[model samples]
Target: MDVCVCTPQEWDTIRSQRADALDASLESLGAQPVPPVFHTTAAPDPSPFGIQNDSDSERDPDDIPIFGEQLHAPSQSPTDTLRNITRSVRLNVNGVPRDRSTWKTLRDFVDERTIEDVLDTIESDRNALDDILARTSDYPESLSNTIAAIEGSVPAENTLPSMQDIFQAQGIASTDMASHLESLAAHFEQMSTALEHHEAGETFVHEDLHDWGTTWAEMNRDTEELPAILSEMEERLVSIDAAQWVPVLSQSRELSNVNRHSTKLVATKRTAQQNLDAHRRILDDLDELGEIMSEMLERQQAVEDEAREHVALLHHHIVTIEDLQHRFTSYQYAYSKLLLELARRRQYRDASDRIVNGMIAQLNAMTEGTFSSPQSQASTHEPEHGQYLPEDVCLFVQNAPTRWNVVPHNQELEVLPEIDSDLLDDARLRVGTGVAALGASQSL
Candidate 1:
């Protein structure tokens, strides 16, 4: 087969030297380091349930005795009275209380030495439920084998350049495609002179539509002062709902749903300003300049939808003046906590009426005329002998007589009642004039 005819640049330099020797044998087999597949297999016979035994005439398939020959009910020893009546008929079929002496005292208190401390507390609660099910099954299989070993270590197809490296990158992009089409035709003639100066600045009007028609005539004179500022905030919320110490605020159905959404946003901003002044008088009698630029873009989209409904009716009149200033600051904090609980219950009823008038002037200075009325002490003088005696027989006849008719101070004296000190200086001048009128009513 000696008829050779290579040519196309010697088949593009033998296909770029066999694609650079197959990219240097795939970069030396990707820097060669994969060696860990050690799957040794012989250790599985520690069979708890994996039954095997094959000798002694092939018998031990886990000693094959499961329900062997099936006729079962015979072994009954533990002091069997028919094994305590078949364990009280299996503790009444398991709902337990068949009380054969309380299950023979809990089967002699669990026999195998307390059932190895209840199988060591059920083998420490089954090794804490098998360590919470082996950390919920080994943390999602070790986060899905570390995201499948990071998407199987990434390299799927990238390095394939051969046909003489795409014919020398297509002869360096056809020698820079005619200086990139003459710098893309001088960037398309500077984007056609910036789109003919943006079509001569779109032929005119936009000073933001004459500052949005002088901000829509100053938002229609501020929406005609929003009905006198919502009628002076509904007359200061009707004088704070006729104030008697103000608490009412069930916001009158949120101020009548904010005055029916500000009268339906002032009738939808006067029907979007009469459809933007009838599309600016049909764009000033359109002489057909494309119907006056489509009626000035429908009057600038109806003045931006009536300035977004007058900024949502001035944010619903600033949230109804911040909910009537938080209900006038909760009605001046409930009328200053009801005037400080009525000046603390009028200074606790004037200190309990000056401590009940100094305890009625010390009980009228110790029972003043020793409780008189025996017809005013027999019209003032006679019952005096043992002045009605019994005050422990006048202190045992003034301290010594056992009872010689117990007559102590025979009786006409009555004097000693001075110390009222003007009822303790008028109860310390009415408690210093109620603490200086509660410190001048708390400095007003």
Candidate 2:
């Protein structure tokens, strides 16, 4: 194989083609473009032979702009960037939704942050500002001295690495970078001075030592007056001392003696009271007994009168019954004759017998006695025989009908001989004795 040495024109054309190919590859892979370098050979041609290429100079990978590759250049001013950063940071801090007022607060905060950023940029690149002045030959000796003094004031460990260190490591230097740093520093210094003036103006509103003296004077007046008021109170208190209270002390002693004797007298009175109470109770009991006796006498008299009326009414009932039975007998005789007449007439034979039988049954019930009928075995009696019947018969009569002959039975009833006045007195005496015995038993 024969090697062909390439001309300068061909070399330049090959380098441009290689660069275009690399740019296309970077675009396809979403990667940054590689730095410029020399190529040793061209790509393969359409002919049978193809060539492998190597590089003459190794690409400096660090020289690529990372900021340009990854981040888009937003169409925003510095003010807008500062505002956005403030809004985002405020949302992160408070975790609350923001409105227009919140945005205004954020705007103020953004201004503060922008000024701080300017200050930080100025502070970090202070040496760069001096370097710019030095290159231009514009920095005075005193300014240089002041910078050196400030730098010396910072401890060695606390000092930040300069941009020159980065440039030296990369074998590159920025000619305009220092001038940019100087412009930023001057603006930052102006902002700082304005902020200091604003703070100083606000500070003047605070109270001075003379105002403190006024408060101290008021406190002293309160202290002095309070003691004099206390002294006057002390004099008033002195008027109530033991010497001035001798009469009151004597009165208190007399009252105490009187109270003591009154307590003893009350105890003696209680003893006498117990004896008097016993006598009064005896009199009360006698009075109650007398009242009971009087009530009993009145009840006895009423019972006696009621008994006399009841006896007379009973006698009248007996006579009335006797008269009714006599009438019943007469009716029976007439009915018997009528029955015989009907038997002779051959009229109502069974019906007349039934009615006669019912009448006989009713008569037996009323008289509470027995008399046999030949045909039906039904019996009846006269009123004279009714008294000889059982006591249940009397009870039956008492309940069965309301009137013997148009009279209330309960009204006609007499008090029994057992509840007579003489008997009532005897019972009352026995009841009083029992009650007294019960009281005594309970006391025991």
Candidate 3:
């Protein structure tokens, strides 16, 4: 026996002939139907050597469930992954039948599984975005409600925060009216330089200090009968006996209670002013948050304007937010003016308190006087012209006698029924001269 050997040229010719034969065989397999045997098992029964040379792989159709129906669990290892797929050589695409000519078995199988995984990722992202959007949808309604609450608390036209109303409400209580009226009158007489400067400055119209002239006129009218009352009181003062001093002590105690109430009113006003100053920026902060929400909503709109299912609802929230901003602007202006008015009022309130406090002291001094002789109680020394606080000076319209106001009288005239009328010698003096004092008078 002998071995056959070929030169380089002979080997090249043989290789070309084999290549052509393989290409022809590949075309023949691609044209024919894939036998069902290859589709039946992962490890099929062995066939003759000429069975397949280029086709990659095939599996039993029943081994793969529907692709999306049986999702791959993340815990499963790659080797255990199911090769479920939707596309098949038996199906048609675009009016043409699917077969070996248009579909590669192994490649198509892997591609379908990969596509399903990618779709799952997209679904997860969409669900996460939906959760965030649900929360986002609520913001505009809450913002609108907050703005409504603020607007409700605000006075109509910001009136209550103004000085006119603050002073008026605090000063006009039934128990406190007279004291405040008199105090305000005294304050006007001796206004502080700061008070004067505030009056001159233009923030809001001073409006004659909330129409002081009207108040002054009303005070004058109400006091018209006071002169007569004071006259009667003065007559009683001159005529009262020592026994009547108890009433004066009682009145002094009452005035002390009035003093306490007055101070409380002033303190309450101060607290209100402090509150206004503290929360001045609330509206500004709310407005900023609203702008931020609107910007966020605008970003969402850019992405979903055409495709969003709740486009109408989104547009409604945007409109509501815009309305809130417009309404908030009015409050901003009113709040600013209100604060200024209240600030000015505080100075006057202090001035008024000082004046009223001084008058209370003067009333205390007069009420404490008792019916005692000059020598029995040490005589009070006269105050010098400038010694008393300006408010302590009595500016009564009828200035009569200052002594009568400050000093207590020793007695009042009293009629004695038992005294004789004959001794007086008027017209006819009958048994009147003989009549003598009776009852419990002389014996005691």
Q: What is the lDDT of residue 108 in candidate 2?
A: 18
The residue-by-residue lDDT of candidate 1 on 1-444, one tens digit each, is 122233323433543543343334234323321111100112221211222334677674323221112123323342333333333334343322423232221112112343234335434543443443343344446456655654554434333324465445445544554454464465456446546866887542446435433333544565565566445434444323233211342333344333222344456566667666765655544344456456656755665554444434333333332332233233223323433444466566567667767776666654454543344544444346656655554342332212112122653222111112332343344354445433432332
Q: Estimate, for each residue in 83-123, the C-alpha lDDT of model 2 and write its tens digit.
A: 44344444432322333222211011112243335335433
Q: lDDT of each prediction vs. the true structure?
A: 0.39, 0.37, 0.38
Model 3: CA > 4 A from native: 1-115, 131-255, 259-281, 290-444
Q: Report how far off residue 386 is in candidate 3 (Å).
A: 99
* TM-score: the better of candidates 2 and 3: 3
Ten consecutive residues with minimal summed lDDT in candidate 2?
32-41
Q: Of the pair 2 and 3, which is ahead by lDDT?
A: 3
Instruction: Report lDDT (Cα) of residue 280, candidate 2.
Output: 74
Q: Flag the better candidate by TM-score, 1 or 3.
A: 3
**C-alpha TM-scores of all predictions:** 0.19, 0.17, 0.22
TM-score of the candidate numbered 2?
Answer: 0.17
Per residue, candidate 3 scores C-alpha lDDT tens digits across 212-261 of 44343454554565566444443333322223432553454232233333
lDDT of model 3 at position 98 = 30
Instruction: For model 3, name the residue pairs that clash.
Output: 239-412
